[model samples]
Target: VLVASFAHFCSFDRCNSASSSSVLLNALPRPADPAPGHLQCPTCVTVFGSCPQNSDIVTCPNGTSHCYNGHIAIRGGGISSSMNIQGCVAKPSSFLLNHTQNIGVFTVMENRNQGDERGEDWNNPIIQAGAAPVSAPFLAWVVGLGLSLALWGGAPSLPVLYWSGPCPHWTS
Candidate 1:
């Protein structure tokens, strides 16, 4: 009877151990490069007036193997503005690369993420898309107005003139 009970207990122990080992394996981080020829990196998109406030992970297109982040300034038509952008770019032989367009120039600064040392989970969604762009001219106007008002000695008010004559409703 003792031997039979001991065998039953051992079987139960083995079953529990196998289940726990599987759970631990699932919890462990997967290998960084699960597939070949595909590069994944952080991406951010910002229009000159409407820039993204944060970065997120994105899979790079074929032939592009580097992540880029920086600002682009555009000046013309009496309007000057700038935008911040980040995304995949063709791997360059040098650290920084500049490309000029008809409207403006794009400056790229490489952002490297390897060995997962940066502690960034590229699989998760970092930032939302379609962020509204702030109006530069509107902001400038508000600041200028505020400064003019301040220098003008507070808000304007009308004088409280009082009449010396008796009230029309009063009788002598």
Candidate 2:
């Protein structure tokens, strides 16, 4: 089974709405972190395996325009594993894809291109390594539906798999 890793928000000094001391507040302005908002996306990072169905939704940073989903496979020595990432990005990135490289961590091979590693004859996949076969849109839809069902009395008996407070930016 794939385990989904969730990052929970912890408050820091800046997260506090008002500083206790008026003198301290007057001296230097402390910039506040962006407030959590509705631009939410499923966030998870799974190391060397598939991710879980119940991922935590989080608010994206101010400039983020797209939700990113990526998979990276690593193979070298006796180790053969992959990493999965899903989060918000400022923009959509074009996948480098099927090409391979030796830059380390069994590097290269980025992108979401179709086709295979070698060719039709070799029959190797270029996209969706590891647990990514589930497709991002489908995954998001499933998660959204579950959340709605759990919260809107659609399924009052259905428990929320994971719940957290206001979703801060990527940091949390």
Candidate 3:
């Protein structure tokens, strides 16, 4: 049995601005098995800034192989910023992908070998572990909550899911 719990909190100040915070709870019965040939890749996240001077190396989880580097342009509440990121990806087929939702606007762009022309350097020291890829449904929930908070100007309670046993049977 495995259970994963996620909680998000959105706060609103008297200034009528909203900010969000999230927590992830992993209650897996045991550590997951390692994927064969798991390769470590450089990774970093820079908010409202240029690419990081140095990147950490993280071993991609199962289903991820190639490394990725890119930026996400986000605009909301009369604010705009670029989120620079570098990490491992499962499918590196597309060079770019864009997505927008109600919580303002944002675009995610991918670029491989941005700093280093030779995209095959794996000997770099890793400063920290990369963030795990989030599930689509979870992302949607977060976005929806964020949008609701921003528009309605109130703090809403987020639902918590509890699951036990082999992955529960539920359709996304």
Candidate 4:
């Protein structure tokens, strides 16, 4: 009976020690990691993709525009007349471990065609074999007009009227 009581006392003491240590751990202040400021996007809620680095031409998959700093950005169109973005969330850190906060969504103005890769013609073929003739339609129109003028001696002075509508009521 004394051995059992001693074992129970040892377990109770262990439990009490664990609870006391947990309380102390909770009381300790967590380390203050340097967090980024509140990020704001001038366009939408989410951003284009990964936080844009120092690149003027960042084409996010979601079509968001990013400036140098992740804080300010534009999407869809120009800064002057684009949707005001909100909820700029922080991006994952370079180490891929901690994310302090989200950076805002970036917006690209409609008229701001700067840095757009779509304008480049790199993929377009310079010369295509057996391509449709460019001026064929124009040549046909010119030939048809010339033949009509030669055969009819030019258009009539008065407009040509077609009597396709029902005849007007002719009262006796």
lDDT of 1 at 61: 42
Per-residue lDDT of candidate 3, residues 1-172 (tens digit): 1112333344644553334422232322334444533555555555566554445444555565556666655454444555455555555542423332333232223344453332335334222346562221110001111222332255542322232212212221
With a 3 Å backbone cut-off (N, CA, C), the pairs that clash in candidate 2 are: 95-111, 96-111, 97-110, 97-111
The parts of candidate 4 lying over 4 Å away from their true place are 1-16, 20-27, 30-36, 40-92, 95-172
Tell me the TM-score of each prediction against the true structure. Answer: 0.33, 0.38, 0.46, 0.14
Whose lDDT is higher: candidate 2's or candidate 4's? 2
Candidate 2: which stretches are off by over 4 Å? Answer: 1-38, 94-100, 111-172
Q: Compared with the true structure, what per-residue lDDT tens digits does model 4 show for residues 50-149? A: 3222111111212222211222223321112221111111232111112212212222222222222222221221113464322111000000001111
Q: Considering summed lDDT, which 10 consecutive residues are worst modelled in model 2?
A: 141-150
lDDT of each: 0.30, 0.35, 0.39, 0.19
| Candidate 3 TM-score to native | 0.46
Q: Which tens-of-lDDT digit does each residue in 1-172 have in candidate 1?
A: 0000001123332232221122322333332332222444444434444334344444444555545445545444333445344444455322222342442221223233332222223333223347432211100000000111111122321111111211111111
RMSD of each: 32.6, 17.5, 12.0, 37.3
Top of the candidates by lDDT: 3
Give the Cα error of residue 157 in candidate 2, in Å.
47
| Clashing residue pair totals per candidate (backbone < 3 A) | 1, 4, 2, 19
